[model samples]
Target: MTKGRSTTWQERIDIVQYCLAHQHDYHKTADHFQVSYQQVYQWVKKFEDGGQDALKDGRGRKKAPEELTEADRQKLEMKKMEY
Candidate 1:
């Protein structure tokens, strides 16, 4: 299984849907999609938890202050305090 394979947002959504349609079989989904089993599992879980929007890639994306969760804001404050 290929690890860290880069897939488009649509591809992730398709994989998640396929996995769900096939009874959440991560191994079969991964094999069919040429992605790692872990990727299939994580994508399906993300889809279930947050719907299709969660399948979007978040790499190199930054959240605005208002968008940050309480724990994230606290961690940012702690980092600033250390400087």
Candidate 2:
């Protein structure tokens, strides 16, 4: 949740929950969460700043092609059948 980098929604939630539950020993909680202490710290910060919504998935740029249009896909199928 730092520097505008995207993180998985589950990661955010797990990190926050781990820290909250083990606040007495954050180092152990960070290890249990499989993230650096810094990440746990960040998630806790985000939770404090914006509540549960802060733990939602971060949006990122995707590299895949868009879904084909219905018409275009039907035309392609028709062409295949004609062959």
Winning candidate number (TM-score): 1
Reference-based TM-score, model 1: 0.71
**Residue by residue across 1-83, what tens digits does model 2's lDDT show?**
12333458876776677677776366786667566667667678888899988876646944333566777778778999999
Best by lDDT: 1
Question: For all the candidates, what are their Cα RMSDs to the real structure?
Answer: 4.0, 8.8
Clash pairs detected, candidate 1: none
TM-score of each: 0.71, 0.52
lDDT of 1 at 40: 89
Cα distance off (Å), candidate 1, residue 33: 0.6
Error of 1 at 60 (Å): 1.2
Residue 71's C-alpha lDDT in candidate 2? 79
